[model samples]
Target: MPTTEPGRRRRPRASTVIVGALLTVGALVTAFPFLWMLFASVKPRGESVAYPPHLIPSEPTFEFFAQLFNELDFGRYLVNTLAIVAICMLGLLLMAAAGYGFAKFTFPGRDALFFLVLATMMIPGQVTMIPSFLIINGLNLTNTLIGISLPMLVSGFAVFLFRQFMATIPTEVLEAARMDGAGEWRIFFSIVLPMSGPILAVQVVLTFIAGWNSFLWPLIIANDQKLYTLSVGVSLLNQQIATNPSLQMAASTLMVVPILIVFVVFQRYVVQGFTLSGLK
Candidate 1:
């Protein structure tokens, strides 16, 4: 009998290649305007708007950015935005943790109370905006970081996400912890939270991005330029763009960079959080 020739197996391939390629293209397209904004921010004044514009500046300069800082109070805006983002993130983490507890643990009217909280998510932010502003104004929080962070503190979406993830934790683990005399708070803080690392990371990134990009509320509530967030500051710069497009782009550049850095760093955690939360 003739020895049979060994068969060659076709190279294995995953559809991820095609999916990734398409996603890459989509991401590039989505990112093009931002790339242009960065390029425009650094390009010489006239070049930013040259007919048939330049994607890659012939020569880039930071002069516009310098102008932005010198002429506009960009630094104050930067501080304000950073402060609000930090405060809001801290508050959101705590609120989400509490919401996770409400969903996973039993207590009198727990289900009813959680349902009431969930119902708030159905109400549009716009509907609550005016009332929230009035409350903040009444409390002398207008033009304050606390005002900006307060309405955003208890995020309904964050609560819902945390609750979903926490529900996936095994009851056996909680029972074991309880057998060892772990209180509800102890079990949640020690056992439940450690397992929730991925969701918390996701919430942090999401809440930071949302807080960082918050425009309308900041614009409405912040009357003093000293208290203006990047979004409001950039809008204020827009009114004078006819005289200074370069400066405006430079301000826009500032407004966008922090969020970009954040997304790049925490993107993996965000994806993992979505995966875990979606499971149940």
Candidate 2:
């Protein structure tokens, strides 16, 4: 048995050092574009495309942001985007309920039904896009925000996530609630939903990001400028300001900030949900 001297630290293995070095390099490489975007957003339009491509802006200005707000209907787009997100979140609750039913209840053909839902995930979105559009059109919902949000309300992935997470919940707990004279709705709303915080957070973050970044469907469904989401509106902005890199970067920054804030706020729950999901 070898004994280390008091106060002497063992040297780290060469493999550990190499791995640490690689991770540091990888982190820097991943962060470089975002850092460049941040710096570029503050730079003057001409300097943004300078030959040297300075990392730090020589002259920082908020003119690009001001121009973005003043020259565009960004406020209306933001509101539209928020409304879509809210509607999609409501749809997620329905998915959660469906998942809970699949997880907790015994019914004939339940497994077959769930299999069908999972199978939908394998089909390409493009395959159904035309059919979905025609249905929305038939309902006279085209050019409306509700039409844009219609398809996003229930996602197969979200239902699967909820089912996987809810399956881990002990049946005994639900039985106890039933023995206490609690109704199924009462137990689900008061007990199961409250206990589903981590998974719910995961769904919220995923749904919000998906709704926020959705472009193709929104573009197809909404020809009205007032119903345009940030994603579609930003693309229009990009085409108009193609020559002004600073303005483009500013718009990009605005688009990214909300996602960053949402992730930061709920990141802990995401990790916890991922861990729990792996167990089930």
Off by over 4 Å in 2: 1-11
lDDT of each: 0.82, 0.90
- Candidate 1 error regions (>4 Å): 1-27, 240-243
Kindly list the per-residue Cα lDDT of model 1 for residues 1-280, writing each as its tens digit: 8564579555446787788889999999999988888888888877876888778888889987786667777777788888988888777657767766776777898888778888998999999999999999999999888998899888777887888888888989999999999997888779888898888888788788888888899888987768888787788775755666667777877877877787788888878989989854
Per-residue error (Å), model 2, residue 126: 1.6
lDDT (Cα) of model 1? 0.82
lDDT of 2 by residue, 143-232 (tens): 998899999999898898899899999999999999999999999999989888999999999999999998999888888888988888
Give per-residue lDDT, candidate 1, residue 185: 82
Best of the candidates, TM-score: 2
Candidate 2: 10-residue stretch with minimal lDDT: 237-246
Spell out the clash pairs found in candidate 1. Answer: none
